[model samples]
Target: MSAPENTPQTSLVHSAYRAPDGFEAFPVGIHHASTVVFPDVATMRSRDWREKLGYTYGLHGTPTSFVLEARLAEIEGGNYCRVTPSGLAAIVMINFALLKSGDDVLLPDNVYGPSKDLSRWLQRDFNINARFYDPMIGAGIAELITPDTRLIWTEAPGSVSMEVPDIPAICAAAHARGVRVAIDNTWAAGLAFKAFDHGVDIVMQALTKYQSGGSDVLMGAVIVRDKALNEQLELAHARLGFGVGMDDVYLVLRSLSSMRLRFDAHDAAAREVAQWLKARPEIASVLHPAFEDCPGHAFWKRDFTGAGGLFSVIFQPHFDERQTDRFVDSLRLFKIGYSWGGAHSLCVPYRMAGMRDGWQRQGQLVRFNIGLESPQDLIRDIEAALMAMQAD
Candidate 1:
């Protein structure tokens, strides 16, 4: 049946479907969309999604995602940014974008565990070669770079072991050989250290940690200052069909505003706790980048403005795995878990003997992710746990 003249249908379709355009707000509007409607076929055909001139689909870009991307890029001093589902996914995207069969990639021996695993997979399935290098090698890394090397991966204050590398020196070596350098900048959160200023070509971070202070969101970002490199990443990112939920993007955006404050607070608290642990009788060594004894403390002192709340302590030589577990189980405030940058403290025990070459530590390793808790109270918790273990 034909609609009556001057019907309400036209008003509803026009007004409800299209809200007024000039509305302003403190927060960006949550633009949830899968398919975007074009004004006409001509506009749709003329739009180039690659240039970010306009959005083509939900996977490509949305206003909310774009806002988050822009803010993150600004913070990291990069020109372009791409958000991924998880940090590891960002790593894989970089690998896929930059590497192919027979190409070689260099990784720090103390690299993130899953990244090492992914490199192994790439070697097996794609015929790419993966080589592990010493985190402290710095410019000496040039000697290890073969003619086939395309990328060199660096991790500051190496994962779990807590050893900072000379990033500028490494970047110099990598760039001198025409090899791209990608750093896992999660620990620094782009605030402590300037990746771009140090000559790094790409900076990848796990936004799930500091960026989403609540630990309720899992997201990652790949940022690049170079337009050509950004274009390469953009093509691979779009082809991989990596789409993040709008709600998570909004959560990260909210957390990002207070990230600097939280990071400084965490840094201060962790240093206090690490120093307290250093004075303890049970700790064999404290692997914190701020301390003189840490593997690359000199480089850290030279490069970073601050450190994160993550650090590890090696127990006295006599402590066994079972004994260490007992100590960890005795803690009340610090829970045993994986991942960090949450409000609650976390602890994880590691057997470091087999993780890398030239295993030097003689005791159990315990990593702590200090949260927004009183340093004294955290120290008491550690004391109580040590007493409990000693009593047992």
Candidate 2:
């Protein structure tokens, strides 16, 4: 199927562009580039505005880097894409491009913690006003919009709590108000869902996770639908002088070749793990988009093909945070760490009380990122951890 994704590197993308398209992608390879030599001055000018197939400086782009950008856009089903040094940079670039001083932006309460921090930075520095609405606000997001509301951010199955939003409905509502919608599609990784298919205008992804696969590279991408809007974002990006290492781009490209295979494995394994976790008597809930208990499971079922390696398991109501901490500390397999979508298993407890206001929840949440390890072994890890927690 799909030629086993083994097509030669020389093959033209979509069989177009008769230019040099060589170099088989590899996992450990990195193309270090800071300056690009142009064939002529004619090509140099083309890099002036992301205008043509030429590179002016390393910060602008290089052939190696362009290849990865093109492949990411292709896989994500977006017409335009921009790269940033980190996932948060992508978010910052989007804000810098779309928002002006005194303009307002809305974010999901359960969004990534650093995102809130970034928005606050914008608010404090640029006179921008930022507010957080509940992730489950969905179509109700319309009520929060105002004449100054310029950007509306959405995250399907919002971070930590895993509250999937009604993206189509939110997009429609924002479109009606002439506001743009940007989604944190990092969790979906473009394999499980297509943002544009749901009427999203901008799709932001933290490619550091699934795209890099190795957990070594930190890169991000912002895919925009409208070329004109994309140009504006590009200007801000150029001003910020954000540049990704060509080597990191190559790593992500190499990961793309195996994306489908790896994604399917992750999905199947994650589903099994989530199901088992839900069945455990010690677990009060499994906060996974695929689970019916998730806030917007219906939307997840309709829009997403699969889930990644991340999910959260809530301890029984009677369990205290101390007990949960012991379980996490006693885990032999799942290492306690931050971030997800890596090959190694990880577990971390999050206090909802600190993350949000009036957040209602009992028991500590031990977020899990199941690795590529066998499902049975992961299950045993969980079993043993729970056993140790009980023993203590």
Candidate 3:
């Protein structure tokens, strides 16, 4: 048989070279593709995108993405998983999957700011009724469930306000009403809190934080034990085109092995700093779940095995917002930023009055994300920042 001659362009596209087989490593192989190839047309026709048994398209998932999803699901103790571009994207996927026009959703008062915005958008544009309830509502959540209520969103120890909701109570109430409860379990990274065991129907995590461990990737995942629920989420994923990059998936996979260790380090360091802040006269309140004074602290202690680096503090009324801002500006190690779970510490100040309904606290609120740095160094930096605030 003779090979057919081709133009330079055709030759470039038609190379038949193949890599040797039997190559294997500890790391998962990254498979990047847009148009997935099948051995034959019949095989392609039989392949289902919903099933992870085989690849049909890049958006649906590749081996790399599938591996990442499997790893995340395993970590979270879920049977199925779908990855999204960001934590917010995971929230959006769940909302779009389960709710439609005329459906009602319940959100915690202290839910993530962006999720709150999303609920409002859904109400305004999509006609989905969005309502907010106290994060500590617990069993009382049953009172909020209406005939139209289809979903309830919970964030363990609300991201900014730091109120750890009683998940089992809320889940019991929601499930009784034939409603599904979705939780933003990003704070725990599925290591500290087990959402499924706590009776949550869907668990969403922002892989951007501890999972990445590098602060370089932004990814999220929705995990479920129910096959039907996973199907709904997968359909939404496909319709919304929520595809993630393989490189990011690889980065996450590379860091997954060390996530628990890093998470523990962050936990230990955070608790130490939180304890120090609790004693400071300049700080009115420390809003870490592990702290006894934090709202719903009992619930946190009951349900969680660990608290990650994220926590908040309220400056004394005498310090005011200006002084707090000065203190934050004076921080040398804790950089001002949003999102947590990296090697570098971060600080963010929130206006509770503006963020919450009837926020009664008078002092300014500041959230801290303790990194892998030494707790002593972070405390020293905070001490200096406090002195700077006093000087100002």
Candidate 4:
């Protein structure tokens, strides 16, 4: 028989080249695939996407994504995990997984802004009832839970206003009423606080922050200790097709080892800056959970192991919105931005009165995401910004 000659197109489409096995390295290999291969029809038919025993399709997950998910779950003390495109997606997935039309969900008044918006949306279009409760309601939350209530969403120390809530108390109340609780634990990056240990049923983390360290990746994960709960979330995950890119997964894996170190550095630097602000005449209060003045500080002291880099400051009632705006703009190293848990410091001004109910504080609120910069340098930058704000 004559040897067959392959055409250029045919050769390109089906290459005989294959890398040898036993190739080991420190980094996890990035595996990108939409169509996963199967040995036979029986194997394909036997594989279940929910089980995570084997891969069925790229959307479900690849080896790279599976490794990332396992690592995240391990970090959060969870048994199962699902990664989403953004933190908001993780929130939505939880809502869709547990909630249905006519079901009610309780959210803290100081919840993340976009989460509040998502609640409004669910109420308007999905027939789901979303109610806002006081973040410090604690065991008082039992009075608010109706038979229709299915889920309760909490943000430890409300992201913007920085009021740490009593997670154990709220969880106790919710569990008594057969309601599950989910928390946005991004602020701590699953390092400082153990959400699961504190009674949170679902732990949602935004890997975009400390887990990415570089602030270049946008990813979120929902982790749960209960297998049944994870199954429900997996169904929603599959329906939503919340597949994350392999490259981004690899990036998170690379940063995971250094997350705790970076997180602690941020904590030290932030405390330094916060302490400086506490004594300044221009500041009213530093809303850090570690500080005594912060609401729910007692709860924080009782439960939390450490505080991360995020904290907010209220200008001494005298500094109006205009002046506070100038203070934010005058900063040299602290850039104006949203989100935190990166190498760069960020400052953002928020009008609290409108955002939360019963927010009677007199000062304009400015949030600080103290980066990995020298605390002295950050304080100097803030001092210069304060000087510029008073220039006129």
Candidates' RMSD to native: 2.1, 8.5, 1.0, 1.1
lDDT of 4 at 122: 97
RMSD of 3: 1.0
Task: Name the best candidate (by lDDT).
Answer: 3
Local distance difference test values of all predictions, in order:
0.92, 0.85, 0.94, 0.94
What shift in Å separates residue 323 of candidate 4 from its native position after superposition? Answer: 0.7
Error of 3 at 187 (Å): 0.3
Model 4 pairs whose backbones collide: 157-163, 157-164
**lDDT (Cα, 0-100) at 178 in candidate 1:** 93
Q: What would the per-residue lDDT of candidate 3 be over residues 206-320, giving only the tens digit for each residue?
A: 9999999888999999999999999999999999999999999999999999999999999999999999999999998899999888999999899999998999999999888
Clashes of 2: 2
Whole-model alpha-carbon lDDT for candidate 4: 0.94
Better of 3 and 4 by lDDT: 3
Give lDDT for model 3: 0.94
**Which pairs of residues have clashing backbones in candidate 2?**
31-247, 157-164
Better of 1 and 4 by TM-score: 4
lDDT tens per residue, model 2, 266-356: 7789889999988889998899999887889999999998898888888998888888999999888789988777788889999889988
